[model samples]
Target: MQIKLIAIGKTDNSNLITLIEDYTKRLSFYIKFDFEIIPDIKNVKHLSEAQQKDKEGELILAKTQTSDILILLDENGKQMDSVAFSSYLQKHMNSGIKTLIFVIGGPYGFSNALYNRANGKLGLSKMTFSHQMVRLFFIEQLYRGFTILRNEPYHHR
Candidate 1:
């Protein structure tokens, strides 16, 4: 299965972008991985939080196909350890799905419609993280999960 990570806005920090790219390259050895960035909504100062989320949600949904299993990287999502997350990846791969999309929403979070459309939600940590940092962390985790699946030494038990 192909894995896709969709997030809003560009990551301006060169250091973060370099690290994210490194993990992305490593992940490609195991499976097809795509990192998509939705441009940040314009005139956010003029819009309410709900309206911004609604607009961002529309852009997020538009990138997906109906068959794709959408997972939101929400703060309140189900948290799992590294090993469990590896198994989770294995399960999804075994299910024969074409694409699994994980979204990191905008500053205001997701809209009601996006929440309703999601197949699942995953929390990387109980503590909050910047959207840019989440990209690096999540990609590295994906690489680690694949390594664990192969019984590699990348993940120390």
Candidate 2:
């Protein structure tokens, strides 16, 4: 299955972008991975938090197909180690899924509609992180998960 990461905004930090690109290149060896950045909503300052989430949710859902497995990177979601995450990835691949889509929502988080539509959720850590930083962290973890699955030296238990 193809793995896709859909995030709300672009990364302004060159360092983060460089690192993300490195992982993306490495991931291509093991799987078809795509990273999509949905542009942030305009005039968001005037909208309430819920309104922003609704708009962002629309953009997020638009990128997905009915057959895609939608997973959200949410703070309250299930947290698993690298090996377990690899197993989760394996399960989805084994299920004959067309695409495994993971999303990083906007600053305020996902909307009720988005949450309802998700197949599952994952939490990277108990600590809060900037959305940009989360992009790097999640991509690195995804690459690490693949390496572990292949018994590569990149990830050490």
TM-scores of all candidate predictions against the true structure: 0.99, 0.99
The sequence of per-residue lDDT tens digits that candidate 2 reaches over residues 1-157 is 8999999989999999999999999989999999999999999989999999999999999999999999999999999999999999999999999999999999999999999999999999999999999999999999999999999999877
Q: Which residue pairs clash within candidate 1?
A: none
Q: List runs of model 2 lying over 4 Å from the truth.
A: none
Give stretches of model 1 more than 4 Å off.
Answer: none
Mark the 10 consecutive residues where model 2 has the least summed lDDT: 148-157
lDDT of 1: 0.96
Q: How much does candidate 1 score in TM-score?
A: 0.99
* Every candidate's lDDT: 0.96, 0.96
Query: Per-residue lDDT of 23-86 in model 1, one digit per residue for the tens?
Result: 9999999999999999998899999999999999999999999999999999999999999999
Best by lDDT: 1
lDDT of 1 at 27: 98
Give lDDT: candidate 2, residue 4: 99
